[model samples]
Target: AQLNISGNVTIHRGSETLEDSKLVTELHNTEDNAYDIIVTENDDESSSSDEKEEDAKQIEPNRIEEAFQVKYQGTTLETFCSRLKLFHDEWYQQIKPYAPYLTIIQSSGSGKTRLVGELRTKGIYILYICERHECSSGYPASTPYVQKILETIRDYKFGALLSIAIKEIKNKNWSAEEFWNIQIKDDHKAECNDFWRSVFKSLLQQKKPSSDSRDENFVKKLFHKASIVCCIDEAHELLAKATKAKDDETYFVKWRRQIRDISWVGFFNILLSTSGKIGNFLPPVTQDTRSARSHDFVIFPAYLDVNTMDVLAPLAENVGKEYDYTRVVYLGIPLWGSLAQAGVSLINLVHLASQKIRNFSKKNNDHLANLACMACSLSLEVSPRIAEVDSLIASHMATALGVSLDRTSILCTYPSDPILASGALKGIIDVGWENCLDTLLELFSRGVVEAGERGELVNRILFSKAYADAVRECFPDSPVTYLQKVPLKLFLKSLLREEIDGLDELLNRMGIDEAEIGFNHWTSLLATNQKYVESGGMKFLTANLVIEAYHRHTAFKMPLGFPVIDHIIPFKYNAGYGIISIKTRIQKKTTFGAKDISSLIHPLNSFGKWKKGYKILGIYIDLGLDRENAVESKAELKSRNAPQTRSKNKNNEDKKDVKNDYDQIIYIQGVGSFKCCGKEISERLSKILFTRPWPLDTQWSEFDEKTDLKREDVIKTFLPLVFEQKQSLVDKWQLI
Candidate 1:
């Protein structure tokens, strides 16, 4: 075995090298060919797979790009491109010939920015000045308008061509500022000037490049051919702020001038987009001088057509089962086929319907629940506004079914309680009574309440179909067929009660004391009216009770006739004689002044104009005591006294007169005279005399001399009675 192993080992080191090298060569060849074997296997697999793929391609063409295509309202970008091309052709022919500047008046949310972005993406040169960007957080507010323009140009790649042209004109290294400021001499730098002029001239020409090459010369030529449209988005804000800037050449004005300079070559264009009327922000120069040479175009979203309906059908259906194709299409058309708007409207409708469903579920009545479900279903089919819903209901469901369903009642029924309807009606009435009927009609039409011809709700109470039905069921014998048959006046009475409670609440809120005066009066009036109503009175209680109560609570008497000494003496004498004559007349007519005899004979005729017989009697009783003095004075006057005695008597009488003049005398209208000092008389008389007239006469002076009377208090007491008498006298005289 040792001999065999030694022979197999081949032990000679130098001689074994040849065999080892051979083995190494063979191993290296195998390792090197291993990669080729793997490659061959892979190549065969790839070839077979490629053939299979080719076969598959023949069967079904590759549509990877088509699979990723997004359509807007079932329209492809190609379709839009074609439409745009047509529009551009027509615009160039009809409008661009006369005006290079176009003002686009677009409705809110009409895709103006999107249009500009799409045009820019399609290789149209655009200088986009978005007013919204100025307010955005990322925008650099302090950057100059000129810098912004340069940055936007650079960003849009148009600045590359402009920079090349500037470099050619300068013919040397120059900064952007320096390039902008460079002036070309007519003779010395004629070629540089011509190149610069041609650069702008080409831009203004707005011609499409003949070649699609991107070489330096071709880029320059393309820029020259292409129109550079300056898009001013939210142009209203831009122009407004621009004009308001304090600089001599406002940023807006300067920008306008720059645009004008470019556009003068007839290739450049200005596209101003505003969401408001174009006339509002249009510069005075544009209006008066027509220097801008602008054409106006009002851009609106495309109206919904059949194609739009088809595109939106899936989305609308996804919203809910309630949104049928017809409903979606109907709403879509008015909203201009805006998917976002349609989505929002559908969301709001669903939310409202859900809320209404929840509310109606709480009604605890099958009829109301059914009504709620129906209304919710109908709401999804109709526009959001109640008026639109009403029109639809009237045209379709109401007329077809011959169901006299009140739209307002249906709308109001969506609320969990009838109180909401009542409150709504109250609110409408509170705004103005004149609008009550119209408001009720509107509410009825909106399905907030049902109404009769006179605008009464179906249920006497708003949104109370259950209560109304219950009443009808319970009171089958009653003449009332419907709750609407209940009188409006009864509703008014209920409203009055609410008003009373509201007034009470308001008064309570005002802390009682602060509102005492008005609250007291109102409470008393309301109590009286409420009592009248509760007593089964049909009509409103006349304001007679209120008037009577007012008068009774504020009862006062004003002193009537002036206290003239001349009138007082004769009035006293007339009272005496009138009393005597009245007694005689009454005694002669009958023993007692009974009504039968009193009517036959005017017992007080002898005392003419003295209807106050007691006053005359009191004055006469006082005058009877003075008759003896009168008789003694008569006897003394007939005695024929001496001249000196008579003179002395006259002097004594003059002294007495002076004393009487200083004495405070109060002449009560129905009472005998009382004489005292001024202060004493004032104190005594103030208690009886309620009013002190302005510009006090002797009687008022007799009272006001001592008391501190307010002018209002005096006027309140006297003015009413005085005016009342004046009115009465006028009426009496008129009657006469």
Candidate 2:
């Protein structure tokens, strides 16, 4: 079988894998083609796992002859060319500072390089794609910028055009560096401009070697073109490297002068390309940084537009993974599209962007996770931050994204607080609360966040800028404040719980001890699946019992937290699919009373129907100090009022409330595990014990035996109305 190699390779990040027939084969047949798309490897200074994957996709056979991949082969490329030819001069003239530079500040991997290369394929006359890539990280990092530029220029076909223009149309051509000094004159000086025109004309003639007459006409039209676009790719990388040395111009400043010189020519326009949520540009040698010997250029601005996501959705799927809001959060930064293409998952990529963000090191933040969870509980949809459209520039930016740019409408990007030209879009879209909650849970998975060694019970959690950004991007900006406060008003009726307007009041402090840390973690786990409390008006007994539950967890050396609604609070930790209730020293019936039951359904509806926005998983009541009087029980061991056995008919008046309103109901005794002294001193104790709390002769009861636990050390009383959803906690949530 003939091995046909398509240009696109299905690369698996650090491990290079070919698409089905993916192979990196070198074309030993580059001699015949004018636009040679050859693949080459560049040495990278980073870890072995990383490569110059972006440029490695395709490199020009001849480094000096910048070739573009015809990604927008025909229609898109043609439109861009026609537009550039028409507006290059007009765009320059309209600018206030009038630098005559096209100034296209594109983000990384948005195909600015491809745009440069495509101009060549279109047979544009005066276009030049500089090979001096500003991302000089690999072996090229050691080479001076000016020296590199000189070397690349030294390779151009100026010599060929000089022989044809200055003398006659002969086959003998020489390098431009030999005859005209571009190092001194810049690219667009009067004499230098004419020399490059001859190069383009000759190249065109060579393109159609046999059709001399047709070549002559085509050459005339292309050469006589009024505009020239000099694409200085990765110019932002150079701007940041700018230094203010006293004696002479630093390489960065020298490069800046070259750009300025190129822009001064009336016929020439320079497109300054870079990427990110770029704000206003400042002079490279700002006074504040002038005296500094070293500077930090790091920024981790990860933002996403749902509309913009559509543009990249297909590309992401092709790489064997589909990105959701959570993926977008961690992988949505600049070059994220390309990184996804390469199948890499380096979260630290954002660290190298700008020094203005956080330390980039990740750690657990229970408070942050709770804040995110709470916000999600309170809101139904996230209000997206849309970038403003600058009628003119946005349209042009749209062209890059292969979208029809309209003066009135476009996709605004997330990084764009001050939208200029970006991956921006304008539209109305809602991020549902369910998805946000799911993303939050996926991010803060207790299993994923843990101690550094071989199981330390609980290590740092995966609560980072990514998760918080998602909370901001996915959840509504404010509490779904439009929500009717009547339920909240009634929810507030319970004198035992306090009010928390927002996160500001909810936040405690920055840091806490590992004891509290484990407590909070355990609390989150149990809240998902565990029991609640109730007893006679035995105030001191109940208090001691609840305290004992806390002490038991601390003694067991497990992630610690109270058995209250949320570890220690009497509110919903997560809305709908959440467990909420209040604790008090009220008279306890053999079964929980209606008042006690209402605690589980607070934020409930007025019609006695549980019609609040959120859904109830079940009621968790901890009947601290309530000893199970087996001697006084019925003789039919199974005849006891176990939830499921007692109620099959939802129509039963008294049972209707529990059956129709709740998904599950769980009951338990408070305060036990303190028995595991020195915390069950094991090499790596299983957290399975966290959910399986033992009573001081503490206990568990049961409903439909299908979903109840009967561990020797634990007592579980479970009534699951819905078989699938109402399983034991760990299994339902996939905690294992």
Candidate 3:
């Protein structure tokens, strides 16, 4: 009878004893195959019974000793094994039928390689390949990859399908010597060598040998069996490099396409494991056209919350009594939730806390170190809240420091409040509210607190990772202080100090004894001045208000010419004074003459000489009658200090003939320069000129019913006249 063992089997033919190596080798050499040898029991019943009793006595002690020893430590590995088995079973079912390719996209450190290794151990024939170097350069060329694939197929002994394929290749035109004796060359033409050529040519020429059932079955199995799996780890690099190469006919591209084609025939399956960059490397046809046959599996690592709790549970149980229970609970549970919510990665938090702990242990300050680790972990949780209030706190600190709020140094100070630290970060503190600000300043001045490279405060005594625990150690029962409210006056002053120009001067001016000016009056003055500034006033001045008031007092009837106002004049109601200079033409002599002699001969012509008086009267009327009145007033004033009769006779004769026939006609022009700081005065004069409706020389009416003009329109009309006057003066000076 023949006995068959399916799994691991151990045969015990005799007692446990050391075997001689030479005798064992000699026994294996005597038989064709050592595994086929069989052993027979002794025929003597008494001898067999004695041997069985001895074996039983020896085995019982060994079995009991082994049972007392520790077999397993924890269930972590067992849990992983069960999950991996389930994943494998599910994945195998999905890829079993006609699926030609399977791609696994996962992040780094997700145990992709380990999972594939486990599958290989379960009797799946996996041909593993990794991109170790640039395939286009150096020793390990593309030829080696092709050779590895062939060698894997040949070495796989789980099935006879590959063996049949090789036999079919020999039966074709490929000679036996060439089939078995071919070698891979290290060159670009390595794929064109006899070995690879025969493999591809044989695959292409596959056909049924006969119509019989056995041969047809063999052919079907050779093409459809999924016995081999090719695993390409980090396949993104390999495929990406091939796509980026200069030549369109590179060996890698050809080999990859060929393998894909072979996969479609259902010869084997391809499992590509990459770090999610495989999509950039795959061809368009492979991605879209063959989507039905290709499958993708994305695997994320286990959740952080579950893994963290599982890891800490054992440590907490073991050290629960030795450490402070509150601190232990903080480190193992609450700290993780806080840090995670604060946007710190779990991996980074673990590394940073561990490093801090290690450093403190090295200095023989384990207790302080533990507290520091706790502080560091908690500090990250509170950083975002600190950042939110940083500007407001800095503004307050700047006020306290008597510095400009915008100073980078003042804005860089770290400000802490108990409300923020406790409510936002769940932090613990030990400090007195009294003199807390003073203590903080003192620490900063003494170099205990530090600043980061960007000038932001780094080591805050209340919440900083490096110093919070130290503060707690020094004053264990100290009360935490909430930030005090700043005074309303000071707060408003801080906010408006930078934006308001000449604020102190304005405040001082307003503080003077101005009880005569009511609050409403001052508000109206300020509001009107603000409008002037917004209307494109070049400069704001105290004189602006006074000028606006003067225009309003005069009923806005100012003349077309610029008005010169003295700056020294007080803003009092009756202090208004002005000076005006006028120039006029004067003739020294007068004469009478006739142009036609015929008027002397004729009777009507003889009276034409008297017509000159009517002409002079017309000239007198053209120069307004006010001119004669102004001349008479000047004569009367001069007569008071001189001979009245003589002055009167001189004025009467001069007024008789305003137009002189013999005297030369002279014109007098008055030019004046005025510098004014107020836009309201200028705009008032511009409005008077702009209201002269149609003609340029039309008189302006004070009672015109037109609406008020915009300030822009006033500026546009006034600027050109001023520019023209300036240009004419410059030209006159140049001529002079």
Among these predictions, the greatest TM-score belongs to: 2
Candidate 1 residue lDDT tens string, 630-672: 2111000011111232223644653321221111111111111
Distance (Å) between predicted and true CA of 57, model 2? 13
lDDT tens digits, residue span 59-120, model 2 = 21112122111123224455556556445445335443333344443433344444444454
TM-score of 2: 0.32
Q: How many clashes (backbone atoms < 3 Å, residues ≥3 apart in a chain or on different chains) does model 3 have?
A: 0
TM-score of 1: 0.26
Model 3 weakest lDDT span, ten residues long: 516-525
The digit string of per-residue lDDT tens for model 3 on 623-702 reads: 11112232221100000111123223544653332322211111111101111102332233222212322322212222
lDDT of 1: 0.27
Residue-pair clashes per prediction, in order, are 15, 39, 0
List all candidate RMSDs to the true structure.
Answer: 38.8, 23.5, 39.7
Instruction: Sort by TM-score, best first.
Output: 2, 1, 3
Instruction: Name model 3 segments beyond 4 Å from true.
Output: 1-99, 134-227, 243-256, 263-278, 281-736
Candidate 3 colliding pairs: none
> Can you give the lDDT of residue 313 in candidate 2?
31
